[model samples]
Target: MSERLLHLGHEVVALVRPEAAEVVGAYEGRIGDLLDPRTLTAAVTPDIDAVIDVATPLGDQAADAAAIAALTAPLVGTGRGFVYTSGVWVLGATEDRTADEQSPVDAIEIVRYRPAIERQVLALADEAVRATVIRPGLIYGHGGGIPALLVDLARKFGAPRIVGDLGVRWPMVYIEDLAELYVRVVTNASAGTLWHGVAHPAVAVKDLAAAAGAVAGVTTEPVVWPVTEAADELGAPFAAALALDQSVSGAAARDQLGWRPDGPNPIVEMLDGSYR
Candidate 1:
């Protein structure tokens, strides 16, 4: 996102953890933890035109909310914007249905906390600051995302395993495409608006695996690993994610912000090595 913002002629101030220096680089970054309110306030000032919160980990939602509240307090009545990044995973799993901004968030116990934070951020629209929340689908790109992990496993093990029917569809977007949505929301999106950042139509998990396998020069077949066994092997969190049947729509973003994603479809990119 920082990279894209820089390319868009915005003066970017990236707030990053000190340990992420190599990953974040020297693009006007402020090394600090998002959990610290004072640190966050110091990193963000009322002078900037907008504040974009892209911090992660659901545990940090409270702190992020607090920080955004603090930052916007002074910007209120001044017409500055605040763009907060959230995820579609907060919608949780559903049976053969696609979720949009208005969908009921019947999330699992693990991510049920997101709706409150979403509400808090949206409430800021009542204030003078323009606040927008973006819910991105599974972010993939640059050979550094989920598909890449599968490709690496395929290359090492010569075959990748799909846990279940392997027919579940998952929404996704390239990192660059997601970044473009963020930039658009910050610069031009309306107050209290929610946007989805998915690019292509939902792709089946098995097809995604096959695409990854082709990129890695290997073959793959569904192994039908039990959910419990997969969780035990891959750790509980990742296993739960694998079990989810999720897809999201980006119609609102396209319609509202005039944002268009021209990036490669994630599965095709994985197969063609263009993602790498």
Candidate 2:
């Protein structure tokens, strides 16, 4: 997202820990800690036009809320843009049906606290801040997301494996495509609006595992590892979330912000592209 912003002539300033000051090299870096909200007030100075909260306070809901309050306190009545990142897990299982931006949130245990924070960010729109909430789907690409974890499992177990039933499906978005959506939302989306950053609404887990198996040079059929067994390795909450069946649409972003997500198909990308 920073790369795209820089390409479009937007100045980027990243809030970082003191030790990681060099990470933001050419771009301006302001030292702050999400866990310690006191250091954050300086980040949203009057010169800053927009603030994007993409940092997760691990699973610490209280810290996240506090960090948000500190960041937006400086922007109230300024009408500056503020974008908060949330995820589709908050929508819970959609089975075979597709959920849009307005779907009622039935958040799973893993992200039960996120909807409240999302609401907190939206309420700021009433305070004259252009606050928007974005819910991105299972992010895949750059050879580094959840899909890559499956590839590692395939190589380790000598075959592809999915957390639960092979029939389960996941909403997906390529990293670069999701980044472009952020550019649109930060620059043009209206206050209090919500956007779903999904590309493929429902990609079957069976197909995804097969792609991972192919990447591992395994020709055998993919395995459906039971959720209980997966929970032992990947904590219970996350295991349940990975096994969730969701079909989410990104139409709001496409129709409202003219977002065009043309990234490579995820299965193909895993088998022969970035993940390979």
Candidate 3:
């Protein structure tokens, strides 16, 4: 995201820990830590044109709320843009239905606090801040993210293993595509609006596992790892999230912000592109 912003002629300032200062490269690096709310006070200064809260602080909701308060207090009534990053897990299992931006949330246990945080961020629009919430699906690309975990599992077991039932599906977005949506929202979106950053809305987990197996040089048919056992290995909340079945739409982003996700197919990318 920083690179994209810089390539577009926008100045980039990254908030990082002291150890990561050198990693910011051409962008200015502000010393801070998301897990420590007090350190985030200097993240948004008067010269900052916009603020994007993409940091997820290890499920520490209190720290996240405090950090948000500190970041936005300086921008109140300034009409500056504030983008908060959330995830589709807040929508929970959509079952056979496809959820849009306006869908009523049936958030699961893991993200129960997210709805309140999203509401807090959206309410800032009334304070003259152009606050918007972006909910991205399972972000995958560059041989990273949750998909890579499946590849790891395939290598570990010498066979592909999927969590929960075979019918489970996930919403997906390429990393670069999701980043482009962030750029659009930062420069173009109206106040108080929400956007879904998904591309492929219903990717089957079995297919993903098979691709992962192929990547691991194993063509064995994927097996279902029960959610209970998965929880033992991957934590209860995240395992439940992996087991969720959801379909989400990014139409609002396309129709409103003119976002074009021209990325390669996720499964194909895993099989023959980045993940390879």
Question: By lDDT, who's the top model here?
Answer: 2
Please report, in order, the local distance difference test score of every candidate based on alpha carbons.
Answer: 0.75, 0.92, 0.91
| Lowest summed lDDT window (length 10), candidate 2 | 55-64
Cand. 2 Cα-lDDT:
0.92
Model 3 earns a TM-score of 0.97
Model 1 compared with the native: what TM-score?
A: 0.89
How many times do residue backbones clash in model 3? 0
lDDT: the better of candidates 1 and 2: 2
Number of backbone collisions per candidate, in order?
Answer: 0, 0, 0
Name the lDDT value of residue 266 in candidate 1. 76
Off by over 4 Å in 1: 19-26, 58-64, 156-158
What local lDDT score does residue 63 receive in model 3, on the 0 to 100 scale? 70
TM-score of each: 0.89, 0.98, 0.97
Using TM-score as the yardstick, the better of models 1 and 3 is 3
